[model samples]
Target: MTQSEFVNLVMPFKDKLYRLAKRLLVSTEEAEDATQEVLMKLWDKKKGIGSYRNVEAFAMTMTKNFCLDRLKSKQSGNLKLVHSNYADDRTSLQKEVELNDSLEWVGRIMEGLPEQQKLVLQLRDVEQYDYDEISEMLDMKPTAVRVALSRARKAVREQLIKKHSYGIQ
Candidate 1:
């Protein structure tokens, strides 16, 4: 494909790629590098890109694998899960503070979850990917994706409720 065509195809989901990378790598710089690397890889394969039935899914899979590999590497010792990507300019300061605190607690709880559940939760809830897309990216069946997402949400909800109702961490 030509450069413009490639850009048109990728621009739609580029943010999604970066978000997934950030979710996995937990560093903005690392996520940016990963996104650039994935885009480069896709550009190199532009000649055959049309052959893929769903390039977005392929790119997402690439992003997922790339970030997972980075996490598994020796240099990943400093990486950790953190979620700070929320903003609401219209909200009052008190509301914003409360929202940030809740989000922070959710992020901490998510850190304690298993890797699969974490990934499922991030893909489904944070990234807003559909079941089929998440399944394709993570190589799980749709039903399996649903189950993982459900379990992840349930765990997060229960933990948040416990923390709020009984003052337990």
Candidate 2:
């Protein structure tokens, strides 16, 4: 791939990669450094990135390996907090605030999922990757992806419903 092609391929994935890194390593600073290192590696491989089919898959694998390597070398407790951005489409400030709260709850629910399910759900829902794409990326059967997504969606919905009911009291 050419320089421009490589940039186009990876530009859209920056935030997703950062989020994944942050969550996995549980540190803002470390996540940023990991993302930077990941991007730099990609930059070096632009000419040899080859097919786009495996680009995201390969990138995610790299992120996981990098985080695990760093974590293994370090003390490995909870990581420090990092600042983040949010979606901004709501018209009302109150609604936006409420949405933020709801998102936090949802994120908590996601964190509670088994690691495999959580990653599957994030790729399928948040990243809008289809089952085939997820299967290819994770080396899972397509049917397994479907089952995991079904369970994940049900879990998220159930958790949200329960949280809402608790709130109404």
Candidate 3:
């Protein structure tokens, strides 16, 4: 691929790649590095990239594997998972506070989930990927992806209810 073609192909989903890396690696620096690494790898394989049915899914799979490997490395000792999904720009102060609190609890709850469940949740729920796409990216059957996502959501709901009901952290 020419430089311009490569850029055009890769540019659209670059932020998505960064977000996925950040979601998994839990540090802005690490996520940046991971995104750069993935992009470099893709650039090197730019010729073959065209052969994939869905380059985005392939890239996502690469990012997921890369981040998981980084997490398993000894260098990951300092990494911690954290994320907030909601924004407060349009709400009243009280509503913003409550939203932030709820988002914080959701992030904490998500952090406690298993790695597979977390990835599934992030891809399906946060990233808004469909079941087939998630299955392709995650290397699982579509049904399995659905089951994992369902379980992840159920776990989050159960934890949120428990926390609110019993005032437990």
**TM-scores, each model vs. reference:** 0.79, 0.69, 0.81
lDDT of model number 3? 0.81
Q: Over 4 Å off in model 1, which ranges?
A: 75-100, 166-169
- Give the whole-model CA lDDT for all candidates, comma-separated: 0.81, 0.73, 0.81
Clashes of 2: 0
Q: Is candidate 2 or candidate 3 better by TM-score?
A: 3
55-143, model 3: which lDDT tens digit per residue?
99999999999988987873455533222222223224465335547777688677668888989988878889888899999999998
| Candidate 2 Cα errors over 4 Å, as ranges | 1-5, 51-53, 68-100
lDDT per residue (tens digit) for residues 107-165 in model 1: 76776677788889888888788888889989999999988889999998998787676
Q: Model 2: what TM-score?
A: 0.69
Clashes of 3: 0
lDDT of 2 by residue, 21-66 (tens): 7766656888899999998998887766775557887887787677
Candidate rank order under lDDT: 3, 1, 2
Query: Which of 2 and 3 is the better model by lDDT?
Result: 3
